[model samples]
Target: MFKLIAFDLDGTLTQHRSKLDQTNRKVLEELDKKYKLLMVGAGGCERIYNQLNCFPIDIIGYYGMQESVMNNGQLKIVRSDFYTVDKQYFIDATDKIREKFGYTDYAGDNVDFHETGAVTIPLLGKSAPIEEKVAFDPDRKKRAVMYPFVKSLFDGFNVFIGGSSSFDIVKERFNKYNALTAYMKEHGINENEVMYVGDDFGCGGNDEQIKTGGLNYTLIDDYRNLGNKLAFLL
Candidate 1:
């Protein structure tokens, strides 16, 4: 029997960067009766928690680099793994890749440097028009074309086709699989007793690896419909 349920925020539980709805929130409150609820988000744990209006739950953030738990009265970051990278090196490498791949003309910044040293190469550039960001790589063909090359260049790092038009680079062994596995170990729970629910489970999608890694997963396509889809589980 499933003892724990981990949720992916966007497109599964809520709209992208949206607050939880009453319907789903009520579903969760009910599910809390039999299962330990958790969130596995691509963004930071604090950000995810805040977006949910600070609903009480454990969060796995930044793929797996961070994890926050609800303490007695406040949220506590039980884990914060930071890996550094050479900024100039990343800038130069991205520049070369852009030119070589014919993405020579971009609107905003090419590389998004994260505080934790993780990087996002938004193929459409950082400040691209919203319409263009939505249109540029819907099929993911553009990014997938260069994913292998970029992965090769950034050896030892885990790369994911994240968001609408970017690649997320994190330290190796820092993906959701690692985070969930680590969380399970820390809580003295069995991986087999947990089920992960997410929408992005396709090629290069952040959730793809975990699904492919032999984890029990429920694929969600739309957030609004998630309640009825998972109502039986509750």
Candidate 2:
């Protein structure tokens, strides 16, 4: 019943920031034979394409700020949208949040501003060791506790609990729901003809909007079990 099967890259198809595995890759490959496969990601198009090891698929990135399509076996940037963010404002606001939350002694830069003008306020600082980041919010409780307050501070941006220990703030115009809706409109596909598979569909998660937005969604709890979880689809 699905015409397009969209996937969230990290923690859904593979481990966070990890390459696509052979097992899952083959599943995508097989699924591609029958359905149009797409990647809807929170990161950039190039980053998602590279992480997939150049897997042939169209990608929606930066929560829909950018898009790329596979043509002639090469990934081509078909659309790149940019938003100008007040960097100093973000830094100042982050500082305020940090102080209020007793996170004044971070390891490095507090705000990570992306090319798309999206911001990631890494609680542990950007340069902190990966081990520390993984340990800091393995269950995301610490950040989730501060989600409402932090989101309130950024009035116009959509805030989400991101990565292992950070919050992603994007323009109010974008989110996974907007991204997928745009995709469906562009492709002339109905909502019922699409399916979204993602891991982070809970509260404060990046995929939460789409999961609860009246669409057909499949939740993935573990990346390693993705193939089994979607076996019926194959």
Candidate 3:
């Protein structure tokens, strides 16, 4: 009864920022024959495309801020949305959180301002080593404790516990739920006809909105088990 299968990239299909593995890739190949596949991710469309090694599937990126489709064997971004943020405001706001939480020291940059207007407040600094970031909050406990405070500080923006040690902020209108719904409306697919798969559905997690929004979804706790988690579909 399903016509589409959407997925989260990192943590669901592969390790964070890692390439798609052969097992999942083969699974996708099989699924593509029967249902449309989409990559709905927190990163940009192009980045997701390449990370998948250009696996020919439509992609919705930046939580709906961007859209891309396969064109002549290449992924072409067809739509992109950008918002202007008060840079100084974010800087000052993040500083306040850092000071209150005693995260006054960090490596690289305090916050990453993406071109799409999305913002990442890296708690350990953007340039921190991968190992350190991964070890900082594997269970998201630390981020959860501060999630509400971060949200309070950024009233107009949607805040999510992102990556290994950071918060991803975007406008309230954009999220995996809204993005998936918009795609369904455009393609004439019903809410019941699509299934989303992701790993992060915990509080403040990036995929929490979709799970809470009443969409049909399956959770993959470990990327290595993605094949088994979705075997029923195959």
Candidate 4:
């Protein structure tokens, strides 16, 4: 039996970058009564908290770069960490990758820089239309082929095939695996006593490290069926 259930937001709980629906929200409310629910996200803590409509639950964001907990029905930051990055270095490196992969002609910004020193290499450019971005790589086959190359370029960063058409890059020390383990340690819980539910657990997927890192996890490919996937827990 699991003592805690940690969830990944985007693909696991809802459509990418969308708010949680009333259906899933009700499921979560029911589960919350039986077990602690946590959201582990690739974005910032505040972003995830807000996206959930400020649902009162702890959040580990930016792949563990930040942590926030709900206090008296409100989310409060408990801990956060940011890494310093060489901005020019990323810009130059991304350019080389783009040139090598024929991604030279993009719509807007070549790379997206996050506040936590993380970067996103949006293949179609940051300003690309949403429809095109959605159609860019539905199966992720295209990005998976170049994942190794991108990962190699970002030597000290954790690279993942993120979003619909981009790669998320963060400091190597920050990742879902480390974040979950650290959370377990901090809460005096055993790894086996926790279950991670996420959608991206395949090759180059953001949640891959958690599976490979020897953690108990459940996969939910379609966010619409999240409630059914955790029916046993309910």
Candidate 5:
């Protein structure tokens, strides 16, 4: 009964910042025959598209701030939204959190300001090694303890424990739930006809919004088991 199948990229489809393997790519090829496959991710549309090795699917990126579609065998951005952020405010606030949590010593920049007006506070610093970041909060327990406090500090932004060692902050109106709903409304598709697949649905997780928003979704705990988890869909 589903017409659309959306997905989260990083932890759901592949290892963090890794390429999509042939196994999952083949699974997607099978799914594409029966349903519209869309990529809904925390990163930008172009980044997701390339990571998938240009698998030929539409992408909703930056939690809905950007939308792109495949046209003529190439990805094209059809819609994009940007918001201005107070850089000083984010830097000061992140510093406060780092000091409180004893994460004051980091490798790179304290915060990452994206072109889309989104912000990220990398706990291990922006330039920290990938291995270190991955090990920093595998269970998200470290971020969970500080999630509430971070949210309190960034009242005007939607805060999520994103990636392995960072907090993703966006404007209040942007989130996977809102973005997916908007896509549904635009396409005249009913909510029940859509199924979202993702991994990060835990506390302060980026995909938490969609899960909590009551959407029909399949959780992927291990990317290696993605095909098995979604075998019923196939």
Candidate 6:
């Protein structure tokens, strides 16, 4: 029996960049009774908390770089970590990478310099209109073509195909595996007791680490079916 149920927020719980609906909310309410509910998100804890309409649940954000819990009847960040990047190095490296990949011409900012050092080389830049970003990689064909090359280029860092238009690079020691492992260690919960649900579990995907961590995992392909898919688990 699964004692803990962790979920990926974006694609697994709701449509990408969309809000949780009443049906899923009710499903969550039902699940809450049977297992621990945790939201493991690619974005920040505060954003996740608000996006869920401030639903009551623990959150693992920024791929585990940040953690938060419902505290004082509100979401509170229990831990926060940040890494400083050599901006000059990033600027120089980003330019070179673009040139090598023939991405010299693009829109908006070339590099998304996040406070957490998880660099995003957005093909259409961070400020690109949603339509173009959506059109840029509808099938992830372009990103996949360059995935291996970019992965090798960032040899010392952990790289992943993230969002619809960018690559997420994190520190070597940080990932879903590290995040879940640390979470379990602190909570005294073993792998078998935790069931992880996510969409991005294929190779190079954000949830790959956790899916392959030898933990019980459920793959959620479409948010529309998530309620029915997880009804049995909860």
Q: What lDDT does the true structure give each of the candidates? A: 0.83, 0.90, 0.93, 0.89, 0.93, 0.82
Write the residue-wise lDDT of candidate 4 on 7-99 in tens digits.
999878887778899999988899899888899889888989888988899999989988999898888988878777888988998898898
| Overall local distance difference test of candidate 2 | 0.90
Q: Candidate 3: which stretches are off by over 4 Å?
A: none
> lDDT tens digits, residues 118-211, model 2?
8999898989887788778766789889998998989889998888878999998889999999999989999999989998887889999997
Candidate 2: Cα lDDT at 9: 90
lDDT of 3 by residue, 1-234 (tens): 999999999889988777898988998999999999999999999899888998999999999999999999988999999998999999999999999999999999988999999999999999998888878988889989999999999887899888889999999999999999999999999999999999999888999999999999999998999989999998
- Model 1 per-residue lDDT tens digits across residues 84-103: 89888889889888888988
What is the TM-score of each predicted model, taking all chains together? 0.88, 0.96, 0.97, 0.95, 0.98, 0.92
Tens digit of per-residue lDDT, candidate 5, span 1-234: 999999999889998888999999999999999999999999999999999999999999999999999999999999989879889999999999999989999998999999999998999899999888888888888899999999999886899999888899999999999999999999989989999999998778999989999999999998999999999997
Error of 6 at 115 (Å): 1.8
Q: Which candidate is the best by TM-score?
A: 5
Every candidate's CA RMSD: 2.2, 1.3, 1.0, 1.4, 0.9, 1.8
For candidate 4, which ten residues in a row score worst on lDDT?
78-87
What is the C-alpha local distance difference test score of candidate 1?
A: 0.83
Tally clashes: model 6.
0
Write the number of the candidate with greater TM-score, choosing between 1 and 3: 3
Position 94, candidate 5: lDDT:
91
Ranking by TM-score: 5, 3, 2, 4, 6, 1
Report residue 155 deviation for candidate 2 (angstroms). 0.4
lDDT of 6 by residue, 1-234 (tens): 788889888778876666799888988899999888998777889989887988899999988999999988989999888997777776777787788778877788988877777788887777887667656764567877888878887767888878777888887888888898899899989887999988888788889999777878888877788888887775
